[model samples]
Target: MNNPVITIKNVSKSFGKNQVLENISLEIHSGEIFGFLGPSGAGKTTLVKELVGLDTPTKGENFVLGGKMPSLGLMERVGYMSQADALYGELSAKENLEFFAALYGLKGPNRKKRMEMVMEMVQLSDDLNKLVSNYSGGMKRRLSLAAALLHEPELLILDEPTVGIDPVLRKSIWDGFYDLKKKGTTIIVTTHVMDEAEKCDRLGMVRNGKLIAVGSPEELKENTNSGTIEDAFLVYGGA
Candidate 1:
């Protein structure tokens, strides 16, 4: 069996009186591309946030890379690209990359090499000297992805990464994901797009704070007697 990179054991989260997640349990295998599929407000972000130790669960536990979560030591092994473009708009793209590289403890030749590689991967190498404030929405999204990949982390957590990207760029980005998978990186992506869900090795369907189903795209479609992921999702949501 493949080693589990991320494990959630009956985890739950609540904000004030609002419950965002409930008894969520999952295990993601190493080198696999896992998709957390759901419509907006389905707690996909909440679940992924817990995996990266950004937000602690109110109940149960989350283990990442064989250690209990919220561990700074473990964080060094994870790369996260949030939905928002968390970039320093005043800085140049290269400057932003340099800053993040330092935070990941990268230095000297390794930092420069990794920065160059990620910039190329995101097709932003030529824009290195451009100020982030002048970038388009799609460019900012790509820059965020480059920043997350700067450390060459073992696991990647991306939340709606392709939202503002064009189809051509999206294809290039997915190609990059396959290249990372070849290098033994575990990737988790959250999205509502059906076509994107089809590319995942396995998917966890979330609805109203509950994980309604978990399986490969084929398994889900077959079991639901549906032709598409959207149809399967409807069936699972009803159950």
Candidate 2:
């Protein structure tokens, strides 16, 4: 296995009196797709935010690319797609790509090439000139994913990336993810979808701010004596 690209040590987070995460610790290695599987309000997004340096833990620490969390240099090496679409309403799809590409220091021919490449990867090449405001919910999601890939970052962090996408397009997106993984891009995805969870190389199941289980889909099922990832999750959740 490659060296650990992400390390979380006894991480915890709290908002006012509510504790969102409690004593979470995990190591994510390089060049694999790791999934955080859990339902809504399970603190999956909060954990991911910490990984991307968008939020800091109230306790413990997070390290990415061998650097401490919230490092500007390390942020450049990571591509993040948040749950909300962050796009210019009046700008065309191409324009949005151009803006973000520039933020990553992509310029001239390189920027153009990357823009085209990511758009094609997300199957949005034909909609390059469409205004973002006019794009449907699913189209917006795809565009957001394309923008995240524009920089070809070593690590890709996606939070609920496939939500609102149709089954056919969702499969296509997953295929693209596998291609990225093959190229040594470590991916961290948070999803409540069981089928998607099974596609991950390994999974960390979170519930009520705790990591309940950690294993590959097959290993999780076998260990829990269950037939599916969902069943394994249920067993872990004490269902």
Candidate 3:
């Protein structure tokens, strides 16, 4: 087994009296694709935000690369793509990438190289000169993904990455994810899409702020005596 890449210990979060997550505990190993499978409002985003240090857990902790989260130093080592697109609508796609690259301390040849590389990965090279404000919703999402991958961080965390993408583009994006895994990057993706969840090496089934099951796709299906990931999710969710 690979070393632990991320460790979530009894994590919980709340907004005033509205609880979002409840004692969620899980471990994601290095060089693996780990998925958090749950429906909307199932607290997937809340839990994910905590892992990326964008939010703090009201209870428990999130450890990444053997150190505690919300650490400024760790930010450079992680690539994060939030549920919302974080691109600058006023700037051209290339300009946005340039800004992010500069912030990551990338300069000169290396910055140009990475910018081209991620654009190729997302198949957005041609659209690089276009202003983001004029891009379609799906194009914006792809550009956001390109920016997240700008630095080739050791850990990649994505929230509903393919939500607005077409089937062909989504497949290609996932293929890029598999390529990254081959290069030994630890990836954590949160998705409500069952087909995407099945592609994960292992998945954590979260529902109603609780993790109901954790296992590989086949393991989950067999354990639940189900034929598919959706069936397994239903059995685990008690639906």
Candidate 4:
């Protein structure tokens, strides 16, 4: 019954002769975790990039917050963490958070408060004073996640966020996601991991640049008469 926070209409993307996405249509409602489930090269990242306005769809439109994407005004309301880490290696984790917070117009005590809150969510509080270049791959990923959470955006988009994170930390991070969702934050997480996809409220199965199936984990498993999300993915001919 809630309004759709995101809408993709017949979206397609191509790079010259190579097509990366084909006629993908989807609508993500507010206050839920919607996931794009797929293997590498399945166009999951590309689709999200389009939604975040980093890239344009070759032949469709992606709307976020009821407005077409790439709109600068919407930036403050959306938080994005790409498949690649985008952090200043020379700066401390706290400094990186400070920079992003300032860009969102957060200042003084509010900015400092937000930085601490986000870092705590990612369990990187101890390393907040450490330079990013000194952090490990997993640590860097967590820092990127922390920065994205600093603005407390209404919509959160993460691409392969838990890739290098350990199991315990990943679980804690997902707990943080649940907390965000309860606060009515709409989240989109792209991942190839079946178990991770199972955590989503609904999932879009993608393969070879095509959207093969879309449903909640239970619905998908029931439809395919499968035991698990992985089995259901296979039944959908993903593998």
Best by TM-score: 2
Whichever of 3 and 4 has more TM-score, that candidate is 3
Q: Write candidate 2's Cα lDDT for 18-77 as tens digits.
A: 999999999999999999999999999999999898999999999999999998999999
Query: How well does candidate 1 match the true structure, expressed as C-alpha RMSD?
Result: 0.9
Give the Cα-based TM-score of candidate 4 against the true structure: 0.97
Residue 12 accuracy (lDDT) in model 3: 90
How well is each residue in 112-161 modelled by candidate 1, as lDDT tens digits? Answer: 99999999999998999999999999999999999999999999999999
**What are the runs in model 2 whose C-alpha is more than 4 Å off?**
none
Better of 2 and 3 by lDDT: 2
Deviating ranges (above 4 Å) for candidate 3: none
Task: Please report, in order, the local distance difference test score of every candidate based on alpha carbons.
Answer: 0.95, 0.96, 0.93, 0.92
Model 4 local distance difference test score? 0.92
Per-model RMSD to reference: 0.9, 0.7, 0.8, 1.0
List the pairs of residues colliding in candidate 3: none
What is the per-residue lDDT of model 4 for residues 1-239, given as tens digits with 9 covering 90 to 100? 37899999999999999999999999999999999999899999999998888899999899999899889998779999998899999999888888888888999998888888988888888988999999999999999998888888999999999999999999999999999999999999999999999999999999989999999999999999999998998989745
What would the per-residue lDDT of candidate 3 be over residues 74-118, giving only the tens digit for each residue? 988999999999999999999999999988999999999999999
Error of 3 at 37 (Å): 0.6
Candidate 2 accuracy as TM-score: 0.99
Best of the two (1, 2) by lDDT: 2
